[model samples]
Target: MSTTTDTAPITIHIPTPLRAYTDEQATATVEAATVGAALRALVDHYPELDANLYTDDGTLRSFVNIYRGDEDIRHLDGPDTALEAGDELSIVPSIAGG
Candidate 1:
């Protein structure tokens, strides 16, 4: 017998501070083949988050930290990290104060 499974969209958790840009949503689902595509789709859906998440050169902001599961994206392929169905991505922003 042969079996086939349908892939599900990836889930991204928006940080509390950035939730406002996502319609106050805590989580968003996007259909993408890679982390870069997922992030692009997210910003496309919520244009307000573009400036907060990425720079004018289309690179993620230095203060932003993206993780796939518990592994940091930076340790992976950065933005080009491969993604599978049901993967969860968390967007964390660095907080600074003295």
Candidate 2:
């Protein structure tokens, strides 16, 4: 695999519930040219998380959301959006009840 030496690595904060899928790490660094690539990098590193993030159509799961620096992904070309250094990507799982 090639390394990203020129661009700063982006950080993806792993929520408590998803920590187990990432070997208990609270945060992980992923190297990618774009947000979609970063997500692919994440799943590559943690195969178990693939099911939680993607649907059969290869779209992000409806119950899951990806935020880029407080911006919702759906409004920013979804995962294909590019990401810069210091940008935050969060994966939020929807809660159910009532």
Candidate 3:
């Protein structure tokens, strides 16, 4: 059996809009193995972010975009994307149109 190694906490960048739920902090560090875990940590720590980040069905909100570094998580493995020790997750909210 293979063993899992504990890694350094990852940095999550909180956008201006969502900073309120994070106690006005622009960034947060969390120990997680995947993007989903990182996001869940945030939601768990700050329950207020739940409504904004997820839908009633517990899915990520359509207007909220998550990116690992410069790559969008949706193009990767969505929430299952693996994260590195120093990986940075950016949460971006989409703007609607015209």
Q: How many residue pairs of model 2 clash at the backbone?
A: 0
Clashing pairs in 3: none
lDDT per residue as tens, model 3, 29-73: 999888999999989998999999999999998999999999999
Off by over 4 Å in 1: 1-8
Q: Which residue pairs in model 2 clash with each other?
A: none
TM-score of 1: 0.87
lDDT tens readout by residue for model 1, 1-79:
2223333499999998889898899999998777888899999999999999989998888889999999899999988
Model 2 poorest ten-residue lDDT run: 1-10
Candidate with more favorable, higher TM-score: 1 or 3: 3
Poorest lDDT segment (10 consecutive residues) of candidate 1: 1-10
> Comparing candidate 1 with candidate 2, which one achieves the higher TM-score?
1
Question: Which ten-residue region of model 3 has the weakest summed lDDT?
Answer: 1-10
lDDT of the structure predicted as candidate 2: 0.81
TM-score of 3: 0.90
- In order, the Cα lDDT scores of the candidates are 0.87, 0.81, 0.90
